[model samples]
Target: MAKLDFHIVNRIRAQVARLGDRAALRHQAAGQWLDISWREFGAQIHQLALALAGQGLKVQDKVAIFSNNMPRWTIADFATLYNRCVTVPIYPTNTPQQAAYILNDADVRVLFVGEQAQHDAALALADDCPQLERIVVMDESVVLADHPLVCHYRDFIDTYAPQADVAVLARRLDEIRMDDLLTLIYTSGTTGTPKGVMLDYANVASQIESHDQKLALDEGDTSLCFLPLSHVFERAWTFYVLHRGGINCYLSDTNQLKTALPAVKPNVMAAVPRVYEKIYSAVHDKVSRAPLHRKVMFTWAVNMGARMALARQECRPPSWLLQKSYNLADKLVLSKLRDLLGGNIKFMPCGGAKLDESIGRFFHAIGINVKLGYGMTETTATVSCWDDQCFNPDSIGMPMPGAEVKIGENNEILVRGPMVMRGYYNMPEETAKNFTADGFLKTGDAGHFDEHGNLFITDRIKELMKTSGGKYIAPQVIEGAIGKDHFIEQIAVIADTRKFVSALIVPCFETLEAHARELNIKYQDRLELIKHTQIIELIEKRVVELQKDLARFEQVKKFTLLPKAFSMDQGELTPTQKLRRKVIQDRYHQQIEEMYEESHKRSPRPH
Candidate 1:
């Protein structure tokens, strides 16, 4: 039996009692920072829960939140839990059809909407979903006139406050068992419909406990959260941050990161690999445009800093000359780079996708500790995370405390822990298929334990590509190897049924255009620029250099330059910003076919 104290609602109540007037959350409203104290946070949750109870939300009733990353999103999440109702979070960027499917599948009766877009999306979905009975708008400015089921957030919460039955809600909250369903997180499937992953209170509690054993946060620390709360990684991380009594600063708009980093200067934050990739590109772009002498000096300083960083990571003392060189490097070049992320950063935990090793090393070279971890929504967001004393660019660190990991048949990473989710919601067949007879969850990721007991993810089992020559190619490895080029923003390797590997490359227009200017290359737009002879030569040179580490068969033989980068809007990227390989290949079938046409003509032994 799980203790009631380990439950999330109880943990929030404990924090309210301990912290009192201490600021718990910070968010922007009308362009001004507003702080919600621990007591006030509790009060809001209590009132919101009372209102939910007024709406006849019984225990285990499904409620949904369709919102961006905001203070209200966090508050509403707890409010739903306080009423003992399961919360379903739909990503803010999810299409109306996606949101509707989740609502219908989860049987969500009451939905808390965020901004105008989310409100409109919900309204559009309400007619299709018979189970959806009411819509509560989080933004006060939303204008929904004479909608029978529509209610302002304030009106809804305040309506039942006067007639609230606190005792009943309290009893329900107390009756919440650890095995009770906490959330229904729908993971987008590779094929067919998305399935809802049912995570119980015990699963979440175990995640918190396991992560806490690996790392502890300071009470005074502040964390900036920009990732969507609908994603398990950010949601679990936020819960952990709150448990530690740290202040959470929510970024409603991801585009505000550049300005918010300086203003908030958060001590810790977690982000996906794309964030680091963009920063790396920007840094290199500026260096490329610098004077020859400055460029040479910067390169020397960075090399010296990387040497020192490598030495420190290995627990070896740097040579006296290297130490002096690093001191000068840190003073002259690295310090300014650190300032870009608001030098107060203690560490930034990066995951949700494979982070390029070069980018990780670059940040570490300049004093930013990017803790790369590996996990999924099923594992409650973190299985293993790199620590202070141990950092490896290749490994995702040892198994986190309380979590058991083993490489099973076909090198599949098998995880068995309290942190693992119970099963897919309402899909017992899928639930049975995903888990082994003995209960270990098949991660679908092919990886192995290194000599030092660190875990190295080789490739995704389902995503591996097999060519006609009977060679298996890991496209992610190929993509990661070449995607770090300053001019290449994104790359997707395509070779599944083909004779040789090729790629669909999206250039980093910012760097490429700057180089074009230096070379006096003329172009009307990106399409024209990519077609230029010099531009093609430049990309070819970069691709050749980047693929030097790859095997002859694994190397990209030919690639077509894409005029535009892959984006979520086009269904080329997932909500978490990972590339949808199949989608990209389908969308650009012509270009991919063109690359293979030449190969078909050259393969003499083939039909």
Candidate 2:
């Protein structure tokens, strides 16, 4: 292995040296937030690395972390890297069968699990996974099986750290190479079986350097980590935060974000677009129901904030009158909007799915920088992102510095840079097929760059749907538009081989239920409520308004309101919350067929 000085382990080690007493990690337990100082972070990783070494793990050995976002998860990640072993992260929400697939595929020797569910799942798979040797449960309260392989995290570290020779870990760290495989992140598998994307230290190092140039993060920054660490987006960002000596505040449960945001008051964070969309929808929903005078004031304030935001985007100062109006707007309305997101957001990196332009603009108008970007797991999280100034909400911004992006055949976005993954692990044929003869990685996404270098994604090449009438439709565009409504929670568009676009929608029950009370629409349960004629009309009205800009063929002509949201448990969504389209289509085949069948029964309508 060729040696490298600027690897992740060494970077964190340097941070420990420079910022010993400062908090490197933070997490909530019981009712209080706790900090892990840089010194403590380094020490825990050292102990864990020695412990892993004592377990007979060698260089390139695969170690899996099956856990939620917590301090231990990060520690285990860095510790695995410190041993020069490949770290594989399993989504904490994965079923036992799913978890077993990754463990057996990677030949994972040691599995670190987080709560009782993960621990139980690991134990169930141990006998089937012949190569698996140990299970370290991070949560102490998890009841262990009567198996010799099972051990508490505390016991594992304490027993093995002293027995292991420190020199072995040192030598392994010294042997660290830029080309050494750092991680094997499995794709979300929206289309098919998940493939392990092989990313090396060079991929990560390149990302750090690129982000340093495009974004700003200093030692004083605090980033709230709520996205699943199993996903490359959050994992890479977390590493970058630590690399910059910034504190990473881990929120194990996203539901507690309501309280955690105010408590932690993090200045920087990264999240999928869904989080921002939900916040935007909720805020607007409340404002729409406010008193008439309050609504008028909000409209005026938003207009002033928008003017200021536009001036900033154009690299010009707002006029004196506009500046005063913006100052008043900031104090009365915009500041309150910012408070919803902790009131100290320097910028939030948004990815994973297309963000609605309206939602993006709203965040900018309210002085919250939601930097929408585009990327995938194979690219190590970010391919392109908006800079601090001069951004178009409709575009994904320019490519990262040192990264080359070109539109290939059929408008596929081709990338060639250090951030590109080495290949799909153990799948040479798959890797070979994905890369061009010229070495550029086929991104499988269709997009074009604007004159100003901003990349705008049109659609996933594989996901585009063609109707019976031969009109092509982008499902995400329709879903993104309608999904932004306050009453809509989740949506899946169905147009392939159909007469016209249709959708399966899951309403925001809380907001819908409140609206039902206002309308005096009484129901015993969600199913009955969604079936109400008035309720259906209410949703249909919003859908019609949202789709006004879409082509007639692209518009959702028919829809069914579902009582329940698409969930991971039902295999309807991936761990990262991306829709498993085939699964959704297959599971709701009857509902989908009815929408088409009902259309055939209707009176002939204009195209």
Candidate 3:
């Protein structure tokens, strides 16, 4: 007897009602304060949902939505849920083919588009998808395509919206159940056509509950959200913030994070490692440009912190002098570094990649409590997270409350709990193959749990590669080295039936200039710089230096720096900005082959 709990949504509804005139949403539109209260926020969704119901839409129907983090985007999402339909959020930058695959496979009958580009992508998809019958644009674009059914966002809601029937609405609300499907989040589709991971209402609700229990704060807490809503981590976290009755301000877009961060000074925020990496690089780059004395002082303090950061408390000597020295360094150097992450930051819940321990330690040394977590799209967002008080620099965190975790024979992380998704939509084969007979989801990530229940993600099962020398090297380690160099943007290692390992690299043009200047060289465009023998030798020399720390097997023997890096426009990088090794390997097969071509000519490479 599964039934609609409405625990989360009802709690938010009550808070909005109580908050009344208090501003619940804020956006800086054209230097003007565009704000809305809880009442208006709830009313827009109410109207949007009622209008959707009036369109003869049935419960559990798929409603696809595409947009950045706008107030209306959130409204459309909750409205779709209140109307008892599945919310299929599409990424704004997704290719038309990827968008078309999701719409057709999910059987999305109604679409809520964002703007001109989104509408054009939908229009391109319309001819291929038979189920899509309506197109509604979210922006103020008056232009309409030649589709048989097209309407502006406002007109569509007004057309299908019903006058509030209090009794019917309540009854409709009652009919909803917790186990009912609430969302179908499509994978980034970097590996293949995106498969929709269908999450139940209870799945989402339980995650919010877990989050509220773990990361509760006083009322009046604020968050600035910029991640794509199509991702479950961002979407679920947003609802949890509303559940906390926290004031949330949506950033204009990813491109506007700098302009938005200072404007909406939030107390709490969550971001992937890339954001933190950029912040770290900015601080380091700026410091390198300071006076010789200041640069030396900064470097000395940072190095002291780095040394202490990688050590466990048990490893520290019982000397107060060393501790005092570290404390002083933290005060002088580390504190300034953390202040860059918005000094008001209570916790930066970083995830979506393996964070460099160095980066984590640099922030921690300065009194900034940067907590790291681990999870996936299939687990309904978060399964393990490092809390502020109880955290380990080396481990991701303990398994989430009541979430059962076990290691498979193959070392794959397996999770069995209410937080796991029902199954992939229209993917019986994938669903069946991806699970155990008892229904535990088999996470393809390789990991292990210590006696204290702390989890350590080791490597990805699908990404492990072996060289022709029969020595295995984790590509991430090599890739991490490449990433550490400022000039390197995106890189993928090649591991085939070959004698040695090689890499395809894309240089960061902005950073490349400074790197070239350091070496007293000149270059024009990206292509010219990458192909220059001197610049190539500089990167190769760095690679040799880095490989000195690695084993002979782990060393990148030969490398080809590409003119362009993986872009979202290309199918090579995930929307989260993770490297798609397989796609890159496929794209640059010839370049990889050249690395081994002159290997015999190697002047006895250093291990």
Off by over 4 Å in 3: 1-6, 162-167, 300-335, 518-520, 547-549, 599-606
Per-residue lDDT of 236-348 in model 3, one digit per residue for the tens? Answer: 77887787777777874688787666667677777887777677666776776789998988877876765565453235553576568778887887766655655677777
TM-score of 3: 0.92
CA displacement after TM-score superposition, residue 327 of candidate 2 (Å): 0.3
Q: List the residue pairs that clash in candidate 1.
A: none
- Residue-wise lDDT of candidate 1 within 167-273, one digit each (tens)? 88989976888988999999865446888988998888887787677665899699999999999989998998998899999999999999898888888998998
Which is better, 2 or 3, measured by TM-score?
Answer: 2
State which candidate, 1 or 2, has the greater lDDT.
2
Output the number of the lDDT-best candidate.
2
Candidate order by decreasing TM-score: 2, 1, 3
lDDT of 3 at 332: 81
Q: Best candidate, TM-score-wise?
A: 2
lDDT preference between candidates 1 and 3, better one? 1
Ranking by lDDT: 2, 1, 3
Q: Give each model's clash number.
A: 0, 0, 5
TM for every model, in the order presented, reads 0.96, 0.98, 0.92
Tens-place lDDT digits, model 2, residues 82-148: 9999999999999888989998999999999999889888888888899998999998789988998
